[model samples]
Target: MQLAQQRRAFIMETVRRDGAVRVAELVERLAVSDMTVRRDLDALAARGLVEKVYGGAVAAPGTRVEEPGFDAKTALAGPAKAAIAETAAALVEPGSVVAVSAGTTACAVAARLLDVPRLTVLTNSLPVAELVRSASRDRGEAAVPTLLLTGGAPTPSAALVGPLAELVISSLHVDLLILGAHGVSEEAGLTTPNLAEAQTNRTLIGAARRVAVVADHTKWGTVALSGFAPLDRIDCFVTDAGMPASGREVLADTVGELLVAGAE
Candidate 1:
């Protein structure tokens, strides 16, 4: 096996560039055994150079600890979020009340709601509320469900979050909560950089009969400033095909259901 420091350096750089590195990939790249690569990854994780996940290591949280603007985030994982949103939108039944949390993925979910007959969408996301409203009008869907927005302060991510938003969300129960998070991991569950957003999400989750989280693979293994929900609280998780093989196994056993869109 290569010297520990050298192996770790290569692994760290790979994670930095690719965002993540699978154990098997590392093993091959380093001409090392699986155990050797895992040991190097563990050492890197201990140094905060990487974040360990089920079968791989990801670049440690950096600026991700500070939430990015909505437009910035929408560009990072567009295809994965789009696929996840498609899977999550399938969960909404016609005429059901759905509460969508603020995030790019949740907005994607809202974009698909125009076709669902009589879908009442209550949201803390300014973008989601507006998207559903203007899209409904644009499509001229006569049976569009009622739309509700929480009254609160706006965050950089275009989320209305604070006491006012919580009060409004807490008072109303919805058939489902379509959620988006800054990060998600088995260790952290669901997390966000903003504390107000965390509290608002918790309130929304409490008001829902079922909760579905839509996030891309990039969100995995990342824990931000505040965690709002545990894996057990999620009724279903919809992600893209890019999720690591290790994550699929863990989520299958942990969540009520796991859906990977665009997977063969």
Candidate 2:
């Protein structure tokens, strides 16, 4: 098991650095059989970490948190994200204020908020803010949701972060924070690759009474550079049922509640 994990990690790192990996190269570098290399690549592909090509694997379509644009991310986790978002949207009551962190899954959650009237949403994601804006425009005055955006430098992921975003979040409190992450694990918790986004996410957590994180099962076991909080910090976690059984068990024990959104 340890050896498999090490090989998988090495493969991911190699792919991230080179943008792609050939089966022959990995087999030679790791001194493993061709079949072994293929098996490892298959595992990574199953987790959405790599995209298998004809003779090798390329970095998955939305593997890199710091570089994947909003459209790329939305395409990667379509059904799972929609299911998780629908489950998370149920947590918001009409007339309640909510803060959402940047992520594809969280964007889906933002999309669902349009149906709930009298909602006020605070966000650091330009895509999410615009989604709310377009929805409000379509719904007209009576049912429109109030949208507020934080000012800061925008990252490739469409998140606005830095001191300015933090300052604005610190002053306001909301009913819940619909947080997103590069990955979530028992040890690393909610984490992101960008340090500035990490700082702003911490502030968002503080500004909320209840925290509900929306992540797909693919996020399991992946750890990014900066961790914003521990597992216990979240009041609720919403994820798809596709999560590995072991991960589901561990997450349920750590989070206040683990809401599993079905795949179909």
Candidate 3:
């Protein structure tokens, strides 16, 4: 067991330093048989420390696998998130049912949704649920939107996830789903570090007719551990004008409708 542990650690370090590790190189360095090296690589891939390719393994995308808590995430790119949220909120029509996933950007979007009369919201985010509920109360009886929250274990991001959330989302459908992501890329699509949240987000997507992803410029080119939807699955994408020209060009060709949010 000690030998195996040391081998895996060495493999991970090599991949980290070089960005990838070939099977032949690992076999030679470890002085092990080809089969033994392959087994070690397989074990590392399963743990998500590296991504297995045709001939070798490369480092997985994203800065880290573990996600930061809600407060930490909310503090980053606050202005950009607010601007994107405002633009995304404009898409919700009166009486439309909207599903909101967990993320700082989604919470911002929920804050802007109060003006839409007769809107019904379902959410897996505790912050989003509370915001909508409070906003509904402030709106009085005329514009009070019905709010529903999924019952499940709460993540560090305050998202209700697990089987209970998926079960509830599976039975209902919504007009739109406002989703947030840890990372977005042409290859990885929409991704998050928490696997359970990924499954919960997928259910949210399955329950919605249209999917709108709200992300800031920082998310581009990042890839998280679990992917919930393909890039083509997004019906609309709203981001701040700070998005890089290279990303904008790629997104313009791939996404359905790319809308850049300006400072408002």
Candidate 4:
């Protein structure tokens, strides 16, 4: 493996296993200079995989300790989310029914769906459904895919919850389920912070013929409060170019297909 790639893998694996690791230890273990280790940590930190501290780094909190408000997450991973959303949006063909989960990444995908013709979008995100409707109206196009918003209580993240959403998800099967996760791991699989959200994800996964998870590089390694799908359940993973080498390895070894978008 390339030295830079190896350094990233070493640091990620260390954090995944240890839950937290220091820069000095990473430098010693990877047999790289302190400067190199710090650079690796900086890269990982940029993706939100690890939290950088004085002389060390810690695993990002797995649980939904603080779900960023809708506006915050929308502006947080701007370029990466756009790349991922663009790639995912292309996968939807005309007249296809797609189930979109609730997350900032999924919200971005909804925004790009503005131009897709004749799309029936099923979603548990209030923000996404609203966006789809607004786009359809603004374009003066045929009411594209009929928008189906899963009925449920709204979470702080703008996710629709309660048994009503589950009922809506369980009743129908779709061509694709575009999902987002708090963490993706070979061991823990797809995970999320809220148990209700995880249950909702299960319903979405079960109802779709194909599952495509849209997550950025930051979601790697951190395990959330609940497990949603095993790695094998995901047919395709759409992530940005900045994903770590170790994360790519885990995804390749675990998921069926890995599409690294925004990479040269």
Candidate 5:
């Protein structure tokens, strides 16, 4: 079972690397039977990692299986992320406890939160904790003195995700959760390719009184490997103006509130 999981991970990586992968190629590369490669591709496709094509598979359209570096994600959808972050931050109340999930957009939300007075933040994101800590130093310890960091195994995106992180997250509750995702879709709702991250995110969702998902327009229709929440589970969906009217309509109907940030 463990070996199968590892092989599936390798196949997912291959599809991500070249945008598509052939069953014959995998058979040759892994010294596995054609049946074995087909089964692996089937499993990956079922998990929304790849799309099975003729004699091959392609990365799921507009979605990804491999986690990108934090800096790389930060470079994407810059204007949209800024706008989404500002809009999402507006949901925070002064002097309230908030939980932030890990991602570049979540870090942006964390940065926007500095002006709020005496806010205590609980987060599994290393970048978010670092950002808040630096801000506190600049303004004095009293500015935002209470930033809780969960210690766990780190993900590729600089997030502490695993059993240790989930254990800490499960014991605490916050007023709101500003969550980020590797991808979002009508089918998957909220998802990440990293299974551990998905588990950690599920814990974060349970710990929060209200959940707000922050995603750029590009995330629409993208589905990752593991889904933590369906659309109805989200309390609010905050996105940028780049979202089309059709997407906006669907979100407004499905989520509690759909807030779109204007041009940055």
Candidate 6:
């Protein structure tokens, strides 16, 4: 293989095994100059294959090993998230109730849902709830469906946690649930890094008649700590065109429909 390709492969492999890696280690492992390692790290960061951090590089947050901070995730796939959110928003008919999970992608979907009319949104994400409220106020529409915030302990990423969140989720029935995942695999299904969050997601899924998973391309084929739901439970999946063919095929085999937004 070419030097660049070999370097990238080595970096990814190291991060996968060690959960995180530093630039110095990469330079030593590849026998490449520090400048060469930095360039490789930059390229990987641009592709969302790895994250560039202070003094080193780390595995991308959504991968099984590293739980990415909210800011990092929000920046990873801005355009793809916008497209997925827009497509998902279009699926909601007027006056329908939708349940959204707590994730950056789901937050984007909430932002898009702001344009829709007379809808009720139920969510376990503080940020999503705030977005919905802001949108409702901006439109000056009082008739919009109530925005319910599941009250609970806050996770590092502002995810509502604890039993209260699950109780709130179980209390409502919704027409659609737009969810996000830490990782998705053909065998392990949809997974989340936190058990409390997974339990909350399960409650939301159980209460919805239809489930739509909103995720960017990079989330595919990874594994996390807790499995939220099996692939068969999902009614639809909305993702960007950049999703890998193998992952698409796996999703197609598992879910009822796979909608590729922004695809040529």
State TM-scores per candidate: 0.76, 0.75, 0.80, 0.74, 0.87, 0.75
lDDT accuracy of residue 21 in candidate 5: 89
lDDT of 4 by residue, 105-187 (tens): 98888888766777888999989988877766876547555788989988877898879999989999899989988777767
- Looking at model 1, residue 115 earns an lDDT score of 76
Give the TM-score comparing model 4 with the true structure, all chains together.
0.74
Better of 1 and 4 by TM-score: 1
Q: Write the per-residue lDDT of candidate 1 for residues 168-262, one digit (tens) a residue.
A: 99899899999998988777688887778898999999999999989899888776656799998899999999999988888889999999999
Candidate 4: residue 76 Cα off by (Å): 1.7
Tell me the lDDT of candidate 2.
Answer: 0.85
- At residue 164, what lDDT does model 3 achieve? 98
Q: Backbone clashes per model, in order?
A: 0, 0, 0, 2, 0, 0
Question: Which digits, one per residue and each the tens of the lDDT, describe model 3 over residues 1-264?
Answer: 238767876776676568889999888888888888789888767645578898888887553456789999999999999899889999999999999899999999988887787888899999988887776577664676788898899999899999999999999989999999998877778888787899899899989999999999999877666678988888899999999988888788888899999933
lDDT of each: 0.84, 0.85, 0.85, 0.81, 0.87, 0.82
Report the C-alpha lDDT of model 6 over 1-264, residue by residue, as the tens digit.
Answer: 247856766677678787678878777777878888889888767655568888788777655644676777888889999999889888888889988888999988887777567788888888898887776687665745579888998776678978998888888899999999988877768987676788888899989999999988888877665578999899999999989999889888889899999988
Error of model 6, residue 73, in angstroms:
0.9
The residue pairs that clash in candidate 2, if any, are none
lDDT of 4: 0.81
lDDT of 5 by residue, 74-173 (tens): 9999999999999899999998899998999989999989888878899999999998888777887787638999889998899998889999999998
**Residue clash pairs of candidate 3:** none
Model 1, poorest ten-residue lDDT window?
A: 58-67
Model 6 weakest 10-residue run by lDDT? 60-69
Candidates 4 and 5, the one with greater TM-score: 5
Name the candidate that leads on TM-score.
5
lDDT for residue 131 in candidate 4, whole number 0-100: 85
